[model samples]
Target: MRIGKQNQAFTAIATSDSETITVRGLDLCDDLIGKINFTDYFWLLVLGDKPTEAQRDMMDACLVAIAEHGLVPSVQAARMTLAAGPDAWQGAMSAGLLGMGSVVAGSSEAAGRYLAEVIAKAEADGTDIETAAIASLQDHKINKRKVAGLGHPQHSGGDPRADRLLAIADELGVSGRYIETLRILGKHAPGIIERPLPINVSGAIPACILDAGWPLEAIKAVPLLARAAGLSAHLFEEAQRSIGFIMSHKADEAIAYDGKTSSRNTKAAE
Candidate 1:
């Protein structure tokens, strides 16, 4: 069953012969192994070109900012998966990564798209970015849609990680329209939405990296990659100290069953 267009025939990422491997036109062992750092290499691999210093720094900062939030749901899932199958780290990692969705580590893409929408609206309507942001947010509120990358549950006042990333982007001189749009949205979001919607790390990440030349389509990859590091740590600790069952036990104790009792059980008791 063919789903979509399949015209392209070859992968541009990498290829190898028996004796040598090539990545984006560079020799893997001789040209890239020791000389290029992982951050630069990541940019090269994704964009097919090396990042400038500011881009590299911004990317590195974002990766560090999101890497390990303390035992988020994805981490818990990974830990539990490892506890269930002690030998399958890959399974545990997949379980963790698969848990990332609109609510969690995957929200960066939503935020990026939101920023782009605001920018597009401004350009299309011949208005300022701030005006465009306000209108976009108002549309979201009217539609009862979430404004992603704003209002973290724990960071009502502000997300410290977000603040730090924005500051770093400014320092690196990568604060462009996307970052400006993010700040404008943050400033006016509360007034428009009738509640505080402080910018979060997810918001900050897309703004900084997009300003630094990351494609919006690849925004989710940043958090996914960062959380992979975090998940690996949790899985390792689960293997060592084993808290997966403890979390499961705690959850069981916490949630009360509210379902109807079986009539068969009542008859048996009677």
Candidate 2:
């Protein structure tokens, strides 16, 4: 069966021939390989153009901020996978990346969408961003929904990474409407939700990157790319020290089987 939308048989991202490779209209070897850094290359690859100094800086900062967050579930999963296989690094990486869902590295994309919705609500209601933020947050509260990017389980006081990224965005003069909306949400979300919901790095990332001209669709890419590096490190360590089995054993010890008792066990006990 056909999918929802018609697929276009083309990709403007890259092309290759016998002689040379081209990416975003630049020769990969001649014009881009050494001339451009990975951050700039990432921007070009995604947005079809090179990043400005501020964009590059903002992107770089975000990447660094989210790259390695100690033994997050994804990292744990990757490390464990590597320990199990011992040779299949690619599979291990895939295991890690596959876990980057809405609750993990992908939360930035949700936060970006949340910010965009606030902007849209403001424009629609003919109110300021702050008012729109309040209304949207209230709606979320009424529906008993969690606002993305507003809280961190580990950093209840506040996410330091979030603070740093927003500060960086301000320094780069990219703390525009999206960042404004994010701040408004941060200010109001706690009061509406009747709890402390300070912004986290996930929230900060979307606000900074969206304000810095990144598309909302690609917000998740930042964390994914950064976590790839983190996963590599964990996988290397797991290979050397062999903690995958240790983690598996720890998990086994931690979780108790609370399901229905077996019939054989009941008969034997009787």
Candidate 3:
């Protein structure tokens, strides 16, 4: 197949029956030359677009933000769950991904949709969204009693990553009213903590992604990819520390236990 056309920095042209990835007309195994961050490489592969410097920075921060949570259930689960044997990475990753299923992780996309609906309605109603969001927060407060953004488990009082993401949003001219709402809420909430209970990275990223015209599920996929990255890193360290231990452990073949072990979280399927 012979083809040639281009969009982003490099163009791809099918030349010959190649053995591996042939970027452009040159053999990736030989002629390809460049230095790029994982974010850039990831973007190029998945998005087929070289992310801008700003985009790369935001993506990088987001990736690092979720990498490791210091024995958060996921980390511990991965360790204990995967001590089972040679295919440890699979089990560890499964456990790590399991933690991402929490409300804290799932809430952002829900909140994003909430804001999106509110904004669309507000805009369509001949009213500004900021004013409407504020009003909605106040009027809906008694009934719903939910904050659009603020307060995090890890940050306790606030998340610094939220601020970093907001800066990127501003530079990118992305919709960040949700962020402003978080900030305003943090400052004014009764007896606000020292850290101000700022929104975590998840909350803001959904907004950023929404503004970028992506589905909520898309933002979620990003974290999974990043979590996999984190898992690899964790497994590398874990394997190095105890190769023998990892190899020695094995799953007890289909135990008929009436209860769960601290290490075994499995339950009887309904």
Candidate 1 steric clashes: 0
TM-score quality measure for candidate 1: 0.96
Candidate number achieving the greatest TM-score relative to the actual structure: 1
The TM-score ranking, best first, is: 1, 2, 3
Per-residue CA lDDT of candidate 1, range 1-270, in tens? Answer: 877998888899999999999999999999999999999999999999999999999999999998898877888889989999999999999999999998888889999998999999999999999989988889989999888779988889999999999999999999999999999999998999999799999899999999999998888889998998889888888889999999999989999998987999779999
lDDT of 1: 0.93
Per-residue lDDT of candidate 2, residues 1-270 (tens digit): 987877877999999999989998999999998898999999999999998999999999999998898887898899888887888999999999999999988989988998898899889989999988898889999999999889878788899999999999999999999989988899998899999899999999989988899988888789999999988888888888888888889999999999999999899999
lDDT of each: 0.93, 0.91, 0.60
Separate clash counts for every candidate:
0, 0, 2
| lDDT of predicted model 2 | 0.91
Cα error, candidate 1, residue 114 (Å): 0.4
The 10-residue segment of model 2 with minimum total lDDT is: 2-11
User: Which scores greater on TM-score, model 2 or model 3?
Assistant: 2
